[model samples]
Target: MFTSDYKYKDYIQEIYKTFSPLSWLLKIFSLDSLSRGNKQKFASSYWALAKGALTFTILAAINLFTIYYKFTWFYVELIISVKYADAVQMIYDLCQYFVDLYFVYKYGSDVFYEYIRQYAYIDGMFGMEYYGSIRRRLINVMIFMISMWFSSSLSDYVIWAIGFGLMSTTFFSMAYIYMFIKILTNLHVTVHIMHIESRLRVLGDLIQECYCSSVSCTARIEDAVIKKNWFYTIKTKTSKSQLYPLKKISYVNSNEVKWLSRCYLLLTEQVNFINRMFGMRPVTAPCWTKGLSQGEGLPIITTLGRRDGYRTRYEKMQAAYKDLLSLVQSQPINFHMAHFMRLDYPLLVSICSVFVTYTIILIQSI
Candidate 1:
């Protein structure tokens, strides 16, 4: 199943096989790039592309037909009856349908394939340790998928019990699919960010270890002079280290420092690449809980933002080491919403505030 074109074919195949079930599900919805046939590669499969397009066409047609039917049968009655709330809800549902269709189509193209390639490249560079436990990830994905389906089914039953028509329940089911895709996409992006953060953490630990190795502690006697009316008393004190043998002096070589610096630069590049690739999705999806969790979980980037004190601690190191520390300190990684706003606490607070304000207004008007 491995293709000859990709260098990391084995790794790509392993990853593809590990997540094949998820891939199959997404493929059915036209939201993934993995081929249905046994072929695996780091590039987009024409078979997947054709199948996804056909699937999307069919789904899009169904969505359009359902929207038309709902507008004609349900929303028209609501609007004629002056049920503003129901009419507004219908409009929102229509908008959501379009958004879901757009999301599926956009991600099903070569863009997702490129993302897979970049991910595989990063995995090859960092090795499997940084990727963490694949079996655990698969288990989590399965549990999440099952929970989503269960919740969707429960909601469908509730919708039915509420006297809604079959079409109405079907629309809600579609909405749930969109919600599932959005949350799963966010989860995958968060995992990627975690992987990058792990490597950055290792780099930070290496810097600390280098500093520790290069440190040479010397014991010195400190003389304190106290003068009292025509008398002088001198007190000499020695550090506790003077009582024991001096530890051997070791230094972090320039080559190691240079290597660390290069690694830091490469990692930063990957961060930027990820931001560029996945930035728009955050802007579109805008999930609060996931955004908040990511902001809190990613501490290394935040630490880099306030790295002045961190840099000061390593000021006495060699020029190369200092440069590496500066490189680490200068670049602060934040998941941005297509360069509009950062996905952090402030963004979450702002979103909640706006929602509350509008909700209050909506209730008052109603």
Candidate 2:
């Protein structure tokens, strides 16, 4: 009932055209397909593969060089001054780059293209005003990304150049490129989820309309009969609720319910797919505090009693350590699955219950 006359292939092409700018950005980083001629071919060609390797190699080289330079020029002084925090932070940032790079390389354009293809198919399943909304959102996102990229790129260079000298600007620029790619990846997934959510809402409205229509039909018939007997003016008061009593009368057919359920299921599966593709380890403030205490504060604490004349510095370090310890102890460490369920015994039980429930549903359907 909700089918559209627009061809699926044509629809996909239109979507691709709308998102060409984003694809172009990914192409510059060698993270997406090289050619725009065939939206179906998501895998990069041999040349694109070589380009990607070269791109990664250059980034790796810059990172390694930056690390070497920092250690050679600033590491000893920072350690002597008890300011090695900067060095540590740089290490963490560089590690994040490598981690993101690994994922980008592993998934590449094929996974993203598949996501788009599946999104288009599901979106087409429900007849909604497709092009106008898609284009508006895509354009807004493109504009935001472009502007953010420019502003961030400029800021990174200025900050690094002032802090670490002009030589380090190139290193930071490479890092920013990877960071931008990661942001784009996340943005794409978020946009898909939003589209899926809209479709699910439409499905809900359709089901509601089905029920409303049934009730309205019954109401109209009652009104017609009452109007026909207009000569019998001696009428007793009758409420609308009395005329339309709630009953176990199925307004929607089983087949219609099945169809709606299938649509809901498809949307849910797509959400799961997006989650799996983009899932990362959740980090909490308590975890970071604990790590900092163990990694950075422990050594300071061990040497506190041994230090001879740095009494004031030792006092400050002791106070900081106390604060860190207190913070860590006060906060409980609990991991949650996207804040939906805690990773505890209860979650395990829920998983088993879900399995049983689905099994029952399968048997009943058969």
Whole-model lDDT values for every prediction? 0.51, 0.49
User: Candidate 1: which stretches are off by over 4 Å?
Assistant: 1-21, 36-39, 43-52, 75-128, 134-138, 145-149, 152-156, 162-168, 208-252, 282-317, 343-366
Point to the candidate with the largest TM-score: 1
Instruction: List, residue by residue over 118-177, the lDDT tens digit for candidate 2.
Output: 656655554443445555776687678768987978886998789878865564465566
Clashing pairs in 2: none
User: Model 1 clash pairs?
Assistant: none
Estimate candidate 1's alpha-carbon lDDT, on a 0 to 1 scale.
Answer: 0.51
Q: List, in order, the clash count of every candidate structure.
A: 0, 0
Query: How much does each candidate deviate from the true structure in C-alpha RMSD?
Result: 11.9, 24.0
Q: What is the lDDT of residue 165 in candidate 1?
A: 66
